[model samples]
Target: MSSSTQVSGTGVVAPPDSTGISIIVVGGGFGGLSCAIECKRKGHSVVVLERVPGLHIQGDVISFGPNAGRIIQRWGLHDKIWELCRHVDKLVLHNYLGEIVREQPLPLPLWGAWGYDGHRAEMHQVIYEYAVSLGIDVRFGYTVQEYYEDDAGSKAGVRVEAKGEVVSMEADLVVAADGVKSKARKYILGYDDKPRSSGYAVYRAWFNGQEQGVDTDPLTDYLTKGEDAFFGWIGRDVHFLASSAKGGKEISWVITRKNDFEVTDNWSFPGKMEDVLAVVDGWEPRCAATLAKAPSCIDWKLIIHDPLPTWISKSARVVLIGDAAHPFLPTSMQGGSQAIEDGVVLAVALQLAGKDNLPLAVQAWEKIRYLRVRESQLIGEDVRNRWHRCQPGDRGPMLDVPRPEWLFAFDAEVNAYEVFESVARDIRENGYNRPVLPPELAP
Candidate 1:
């Protein structure tokens, strides 16, 4: 396959040869799918390989801020996403006694739009549908066994084990969007850094409010009766968050507390309702009542790793995206959102650099994205600490602070195109280097 022709400045380049630069995306989760869609939209031939046979619906809900919403709108998926999402109006913080401590209204104008809350599975399905519509190939039940870059370093690809047979596929570029436990990360970096436990585990449950026999108490009413709202309770070393989804047809809650015993980092572990109720024991009547009615619960251990030294390989033909590149805490609410941003920026960088300069493009992608992701991860850590250590007397700004507009107003696609040349040129002149603080993240 021939490299795509380069177009200088802000113009979109025409697709290269009939077989545009081939890109193999490993993993079919939100990040992988989003990257595939963006790359395909840029006229690249793309394929997604997944280890699982079908959609992994382990996570219950996800929050998409305006940064992610902009990309969704660009992909013409806003209507579809809106259908599955509930617009969050306010976030209400309560004490252990269930008394309202602070109510913070979501900054709609600053956010560029209302924040969206929806099931992770539904969002995944929507992106999958869009990818299929674009004729992008998505293969399931194919596990990547190894990654390799051609001897000349002009191309890269992966070896996969599919249907009990080993298949070797080569592409001009390889995007590893595999989740937190990324195999490609190990292959590219030549070592593995085990994820460290955050000393916290979350018990989550989702069900219909009415069917669960949850009485319409003030707490429940505040959460489900009006415009979308998020209710949270902060205790010594634990926190509870509840919100409605799909127009209050469904409600989900997660109880995150210090973990004292050994627990795997998996997302689905059968949790005893009695254990969950006991955790929130003397807290609030409504909180206990809500937990008592939950049909089932899953315990997910929270684990985190240090910022990766780099997200690109020496060959640069193979690169990591999404969780494979940067992982985040659940509190960040930016896990999926950051992944979406990564995909868009990567695609735009590729488009601007053209196929012949793929390595430079990948470098540009990393330069523009690294600090932003790191900042968000740190923010997540900060939020987690504040929520866990918050005392009963703490109120208002102590519990919640207004987030910076830059976090929500960013358009990754536009930003990437605007800065691609300078970033790529810098990489070519001097090897890729980290910024003390990227301008985007500067206070």
Candidate 2:
């Protein structure tokens, strides 16, 4: 079949006769940019709209497990990521007293072995640059306010508020890659259920690796000092995670707590070095001393959303992806990775559908993506809650509930499709069914 074909009755313009689909991805973060690039690779036109001025969404450090690392490698971003990422070689869990509690070596044998590295900024830059190089029309500072759809509920477009004007643009498909607190999601939800704040606050900071000198023997004793691994000092209600980043040029510090104050989901706020210091004042001298030299900090509040009824909206000609679809806590570190996976699968599904059925392809997309993404969000929250319980003397005996292998072992491109196909088959079998879990489960 050619890339695109006009139906006998409908007049909607499709992808090029030689291309499979045309898509607009809202949000230029890792996931959005990746989807745009993958779609272009599959012979489709893509446009990325971002509210931020630049692609750099600031954060201290992020880890990509072996599964996610593979996608990063496949995207031709391995080299660039490695240049900026600190290769953590172990997984060290510690008690609030700065004592090593558990240690596991990083399983991957090669640095970029399976296509994973750990730099937030580096990964963002690579995806952003690659998307542009591939001809994705990334329009920055474009705030997408709403989505509008045709009467058929098959075609859709996004309404944007940019530069003192409202602009609406149409597309064969509309992807809401917007972050949590997404405006597009409201249209997809068709109801009002806002994201809830978890009352958790985190202070993030970065320091020069050489100046901080965190590799000293005493620090390594309890810190789980290695490549790719991180050390955490877990307390009753607060904890700190310290990891290496920027290829060892910098050390990333994070302090999280269930503070009573309502925290906003802002990641760029200037963190007070002294405020963070107050938390660990009595910790081991070595850990305290090292953190004292921290150069800068960023503040972020933890926000969470309940599981949505479904991420696809027939009336809005829009669907949610990435955080816009399912926002997870930072503890899972799978947020960015999952979005990257979504991009890849979205591109593949669109290509396979043939442009004659663009709307059908998007429906297939929601069927393929919703469950896996939903499961991921739940898993992240579970981990955060469990890890949050490991502070001080409250450290429970080795957790009886083992980690879900499916969560980390997942290969989005390979495994996510299986889930998607099932949903599509069910949809076909059930006749355009929309999932309705009990009211208690609806977001």
Candidate 3:
């Protein structure tokens, strides 16, 4: 194993902190960027290494439940989020024939309770721009190759291939915010089990309001002019979801199905326009016509993993966050949200632990975060099963009347700090109790 005491590869000897700790965030996606921003706010020097040059704005509109909405607000981007997003008032469920079978109102309590909804493009800009303003040293085209933790597990760092040069950067803290297939995770924990395909393919695309005309039919429209809505078709073995973005100027949609058929791994790989049109074969005329107007479609193979028992490494020096820690299917629509939660909770844990006891702080963070993320992962799985059914069946908890209060009511910012303090108390009282590490995290 490589040591964290020095920054190798780069001739410049990057000095360690004298006043505060240093952190390196691998991956510049939503999760990684959020972690980098929060770490800087708390008086830490941070660097974010992103393989992509700048942000790659894709996906039409990404939905965020109340839990994630609240985090965006606390991050001071609520106004911008609302400005950039169209507010969704309800979610409508349809059958394969495009008949509106069920319509569930957006949980009202979620509004004042947790507070807002998320629009993907707007949320991305808010986070990205804010990180830039905070003086976060984000270097694009820097790909991380591996992570090296100290033998004593006292500190962790990573090596990156930036601008055709391999540079080893050391920090008091290292975050593996890399996506589902994370190199940092593989090096730190020593496992390279790639994300397994869940036997489903998804077709996604966004349409500008001008070219893809909006529907005025009351019966066919899922959302009114001002209100955005999530409309979907659920069957025994397949499902499709659609919604508007940027206040209805654009529509984003996805189709998911089981692996009886083959699909590609790329999330943005193009699909035959006719194939998508064919999938909604029997959809209501109005819905069918609207879908037919889609300009293009991107197809991707869906992947998932069995719930890991825990997320903490035994040494407790380096742990996974975001997709690295818990990769979920789109059925939950909470991947970005959960990743945001991971970054915040981890930051709060370290904050509470203070700088003196880094080891104990890491342990406490893992203990508090494991159960919540695990429960969420199971909920996502249940959702996937219910959504991808090929034949009609009674709606499960996902479509249950009066949706579960636990999900929409979650407030990550408040709950995050609250959970961190609670876990710290437990560790203080019981001593260093070693919980079982998740199968994914286990060596």
Candidate 4:
């Protein structure tokens, strides 16, 4: 057993003996890349495989709560991330007619840390650069086709197709972070369980403030006042969320409404400006004016599957993380935050378990995460339902304002360390036991 601390991108040294297990993380998105970084910090040799040929910068803006911000700070990307993101100061809710429903202040020391609103592309670039700087092997343009485990079930790996060539790579553990439509998911469940439609679809658009004629006005002035803000308009079966990003240089909004059509699970679709306006036709002039200036938009169908029975494979050498393990509604505002948590906890568990107990580490990761993820998914569902069902007179608990402290103040790395011994002991003595929420985070 060697003991040496590896230097990370932040110039901070990780714990002693941080290297041993070889891990292959599939998908290279938020979850995969973050996991690779954490694993590398733990002294594990990690390889990240992304199917795309280049950087994936398709989506618009995303929010990261304090839960993720703390991890970013730990990883030494706090300053860089703050530079790329806008700190949200407040959230205002309005009815269809643009009447104020409520206002919530996101003061400093919010949930133990400030929140961020930024472009997804910028966030991805920051993480990608950090991963490369740390020497984590990242291979792009490789699509995974199959997953396999050794006959003895001690090792798991994947077979991928890169360009015209098929390649097989083996690792001590395989982590599938391949998004909601994961190919590795079927292998874990022994069958395909496609994501089900949430009966809702979102039309999203992002554009430069100047090009989009996004001048400050009484209706939209709240967004351009230096501090970041989220302005929402709620209507029967429809809602719109608008905010600024890239330091107010860009404006982005999403219109979510009940959909009856059976749409594909793709993240985006070219949408006409007329159609985008139609969704919010009777709501407010500011909403129309803001969206009409956008040159283009993408229509995304929201879909979700049931809670997976388990994230670990039968061999226990392979496991799922992030969306591959649990998918959440955009309403949750936790999609990226939860994925970040997954990576940290998984790495901590693997580090504590050491190489010989890889199976136990994987099981422990799933046991610790499943219930918490389910709780978030359910909260997302509840919030989505309330937002869509809200009418002129009724609006439920406004968007988890001041977000539950339990959700934001959690430190995955610390929690994993605190629970690893007990979790491993339970797994050793009684197989896998369903884990309960740490009393601090429990509702």
- Report the C-alpha lDDT of model 2 over 284-305, residue by residue, as the tens digit: 5655655665766676777777
Give lDDT tens digits, candidate 4, residues 267-376.
56788888888888887788887777677888888888877777888888888889888887888888888898899888888888889988899888888887778776
Provide TM-scores for the models: 0.91, 0.83, 0.84, 0.92
Candidate 3, residue 414: the lDDT equals: 62
Per-model RMSD to reference: 3.8, 5.4, 7.2, 3.6
Q: Candidate 1 lDDT, tens digit per residue, 142-224?
A: 99999999889998988999999999999989999999988888877789767777788889987777786443655466556
Worst 10 residues of 1 by lDDT: 8-17
Tens-place lDDT per residue, model 3, 1-22, is 2656533211112233322667
Error of 2 at 248 (Å): 3.3
- Clash totals, every prediction: 0, 11, 12, 3
Off by over 4 Å in 1: 1-19, 107-110, 215-222, 261-267, 434-443
Candidate 4's clash total is: 3
Which residue pairs in candidate 1 collide? none
